[model samples]
Target: MSRDNPTSLEQRLSVHLQPLYPDEDPARMAQACLEAMELSPSATPVKPHANLWSERDTVVITYGDSIRREAEAPLQTLRQFCHDHLSDCISTLHILPFFPYSSDDGFSVMDYTTVNPALGNWDDIETLSAEFKIMGDLVINHCSSRSLWFDNFRQSIDPGASFFYCAPGDADTSMVVRPRTSPLLREVETPDGVKHVWCTFSHDQVDLNFENPDVLYEFIKIIRLYLEKGIRWFRMDAVAFVWKKLGTACINLPETHELIRLLRLLIEHKAPDAVIITETNIPNHENLTYFGNANEAHLIYNFSLPPLLLNTLITGNCTHLKSWLMTMPPAQFGTTYLNFVASHDGIGLRPTEGLLSEWEVDTMISTLQRFGAKVSCRTNAQGEPKPYEINISLWNALQGTAQHGPDTWQYARFMCAHAIMASLEGIPAFYIHSLIATENDYERIENTGHFRSINRHIWDADALSDALQDTGTHHHKVINGMRRLLEIRCKQPAFHPNATQFTLHLGESLFAFWRQSTDRRQSIFAIHNISDQPQSLNLSELNLVSTDQWTDLISEQHFEDRVAQLELAPYQYMWLTNL
Candidate 1:
């Protein structure tokens, strides 16, 4: 069927829905899906654009209330901060789950249509969206147990009576995979009888039943509402575990991918430039599956980059990092990676399952623990507790190398990480805390009794402004360095998200890669010394053209001799380019 034909809209919908609902009438469900999207059957469909993102795209992830002031709303404060400081570099602001919630910060959403009054109103979000692209979380896998939908389910009422997944007490679930160590089933009392509800993350967050068509319709309406409110990017949180079967590993089911394709189709038909990003923090191979044939997700989180990059800097060796990079397949057109070193949550270990050795993982975890980091655990199939993620601030996590304790190379190491991320073949996202160089908030963990809270610190806007103004503090230095790197990155056509990338072999001490612009008009050799010791690089190794003038973009130094040896300081990086 031709996607450009308006009649094929319904057919495409049935193509995705039939596999999900084999016994149901697919045509009727397709009509209902169109109704939910507020689109008529004959409405003109917008064609998906080939280039939706570019080299200038950079994202900053933060909570709605991450920075607060005395009287003004946090969102307003955040808007002012971005306009004043981040206007030149950042292109998108991902406000993490700004909805009313019962637990798990904002992930356990109580309502999907309304913004959290405590943070701000939709007007605040709309105002911010005027200056930057806004990314919102769908939180598709689960909802707060205290939500109105759950309340309806408890009373066996309409809209949500059959909204949640229920299983028999004796159902086989030993093969299920989850990130949390919490019990899988939560016993809830309904008017009918006692029912065991599926709780993938925690008992307070009940998983939804996608097997029910109404549930899918409800989220389609929610997606439309977000689009009306200026949310250009939809981050599908914990989407991999949305479908389940009793005796199988409940993660990454085929039904889930079909649903993602359906959502992407609906979203793009309405707004051609809107993006759908999947947040699957599983193993690298499984995570890549979210981008099925360039139809499912517009972007997938580069989950392995965090642990691998962290290990490279901490261990001062790039053997594992280089190996992993060489094996990764470049994303197809209209799809790419969302690269980041840290976010609201901890650095997940699951992505390193196949990339790093057992001893290497254990050593990295121990070193992070020595630096005052906490480890969160999950239950294995055999019921053994295993480390799931390392909970620490990015600033503190890179205090020193594993071979040697804390050292004087912290600033250089920190800046080097961002340089590499910005130069990679994806849109680089930086957590707000990382840009400010915020340390782990042990006090927050003590207050909230959650390991993830260690990295989720609330900053006072006044104090943060003062800290950034003081040139002596690392906060000022880090933000300044980040802005400089991003400014340089946005000007280079070779840094486009879909540019050609090839891993360069410069031995384990130095990590290098070559990226050429899609038009082939520009080329950049991104080289970094991921060690504390100075390293020498022969210019001949880069194969620079003798006719063209070569220059280092970072230091703005012109290379006069093609064969001259260059010494890089500890944790130093260079963007060698020929314009």
Candidate 2:
């Protein structure tokens, strides 16, 4: 425990454990943690000098069961697809919730130790990890009521009864911030009697009680097991609601942050190169809190990006998006935003609460509805439901614009959106559905009775392959366009996660920004025309270097002569670098 040898695992564990378990013996707890760490599997080697946050780190967010075939395991097909198509462009595979689950896709985990048999086993995950960096969802907030832990709780077992939050049937829960209209306290039949348990998302997904140190220990053991299987990246699903307390909002609470910090310290202590990204789809101000004094999440999801991008493209105005971008919190020393346009979930509207006005949000919602998007709502503190997210593929969400139709024009607009996303000052991530230009799946939604099914599409491997291989299809075009942008982005030092960014106000319909690398050796000026018609840009007014020759990294086209004023085609973007 001396200063010179500060990294002794026991000392580090003592420091973290003492804060959470002050009354418990630190040595005993530390020894128990060491034993848990020792039981975890050994990690497979990745790259030697790999940095978790880098321009080279591009994540493809997909479900383990996203792709399927007639006779083979879905993961096998997925691994083969990544190798065949995405090996060159994507750096990490963020497979969302592959664990054995009862509901909510894979969020309602029934077992943390095993993968769903339909998706194959841990071997498939290891196979995928052997090729690319893998990210697994640590669904730490809640687990299925049917899980063994919950079953043990129902049987009044010691550790399992303490694993979840259970209160008297008449406990006051009026102050809880509700993300859904469902009752906060769900009645469950236990051996002792019927008790009310905390169910944040749904009745089946029981919230874990972190006030009990054993719950934290259980999650740590699960994470260690994942690390041993070569999962270097973990998306802490619904992490903001992990530690709940009555008479409070129960979201982003201090104790929750402490838990995150503890997990971060332990992960770093064990696997120095591992990453933990928090998935808190809340308001912009509250979401960033997960980066707890640089001790929590390695990356926080940029929830504002999806809605803001849609607003900019739909309204043909850059005011809201640009204003928010300018005021965005600067990326700290070891953390950055996980900039994404879409994911397995819908486009979150909560992040834009203060940024977009009520009228603006309504207008955007109506526009998306016209383009075949569905809106899901969440209850406010006063119990009135409001729009929380838009359920549709990002491509379709941007398709309602009058500037472009449903085919190539939509693809061009989609490419324009991603161009800005990649050029931003953070690691860019793409949802698998977005990469292939999928639209809202109305049939799936009707069949499953799941509102989010609109954005979650299951593809047949052979059919998907055919579409991707055919150059004329929209799927082929979108995938290729995204790949080209990602390839260009990964090679640019200015796109580093810790780069300094400055917003450039070109016009109402023109969105632009400049990224200067940490080393100052590279600077990139990214400009986008969100309008349906061509827009003229004046370089002099923006105080840019008035150069006669400026080259776009994406198109590789040289702009000569009239560099002071240039025209951008409808839904076009340029990553310009001065030579």
Candidate 3:
């Protein structure tokens, strides 16, 4: 980037890609462009209320449910929940993967056409999509090995199939079996004489070869049809691994990026209403590449945020979050982040960029990885630490049924984490189960043959909801506390963007940031302490006149900014309104 600046994707690509792509054949180049289409095909209809993103502004509660196997069950709850928590503030609903998928938590989608029958019928999806203005997220990166696409690719490589990508004769067998860091690995097998085929996470899940133009075309068709049915967002699952060429890590490939661009183009040309949000579980710098100058995805899931939030809590720091903020380069002014702390998945150690110093990261992530490793815990009659895996010690540090931080420190810290999130640079999203504190650390659902559904649970949602509905329960206290922050955030104008300057007081574990809209019409500031101990701040350095008198939205509490320091309870947050 210094003296030899590469101007185009092809130019930047040629250096490392010449070995694979060879020359720029127009056909291949066109295919590459189609793969990352910025707009949908011209044949696609431009319908209303389909891709309303920034205009359809809402502070949504994004729940990463597997699918609509039984739509009536969750759909009903979703409708009700929407009306209650999100109806006014959130106009768009993101139901993650309502279609049937393979064991890898539905990323191995079997059929992209309809919601799996296990969840509900096609009619149910239509009903749900029609009943209320909601956004449905369809996973479109990989497919289950059992899918018709994979069947054709292996047992019957029919040219007219218009579905799967068949390797040229011996290519499938020719590819090597290796463990690649990236999720998409080329893996197929010769099962009892009939050679099966695919690029996949595992042998069970097969990746659709987008290299085949027909496969690309059919995938686009699926997007357009969903647009007709009111699906507003398509989350590209494992999207970075879409294009694979041996040797190099098959990730963030030029072709993969091109594919997203083409999809965006086709969507813009056809539907023009729905938004494409890429689910690249990478760091802020890498994730921003998904925007492709606003030609790829309209939004992206801030996958680093959850761990970033939790890390800030455990380490009593905001430096990493602030540093990442400075490095995040979004495509345009209007793009937003689908922000949340927890989703359907476990806390992934991703975005391993400059979040922490190399030594610190190695120490911290090694510690986290150790926490996740299999461990047998034993306790004495008095219930204290005994012989166990190192994971248990680290796990307990995160409030695993034992006192690690302080009394109610975990709960208070957790609540403040959410409050701070709700006040971050983007629309703060909450996983419904996390609100009620669904702390099911029951790890081994994978052993019951439901390997992928290990973390999946119906949840004791009714009890939590009812308790919150009742005024006196702890559930009410927690939910209302979260509700208060959310309700206040909705009224303020500053938190609408995803990129903003952060001001941190390192000693107090406090973070402050203001998102000033480009037009300067609105600005919002969030103040938070990640520490377990009570902290205070003196803003004489911040140059605010009488930092003493300011409007605090969270509890409707007023503060008088004076030369004297203002006190903050442990894990307290302030939503301040000012220029």
Order by lDDT, highest first: 1, 2, 3
Error of 2 at 332 (Å): 1.7
Clashing pairs in 2: none
Ranking by TM-score: 1, 2, 3
Local distance difference test, per candidate? 0.93, 0.84, 0.56
Off by over 4 Å in 1: 1-7, 43-49
> Candidate 1, clashing residue pairs?
none
Q: Could you tell me which 10 consecutive residues in candidate 2 have the lowest summed lDDT?
A: 40-49
The sequence of per-residue lDDT tens digits that candidate 3 reaches over residues 459-492 is 4445546767888765567666666556666655
Name the better of 1 and 2 by TM-score: 1
Q: Which stretches in model 3 have alpha-carbon errors above 4 Å? A: 1-72, 130-133, 157-196, 357-406, 441-455, 470-474, 498-508, 545-549, 560-562
Better of 1 and 3 by lDDT: 1
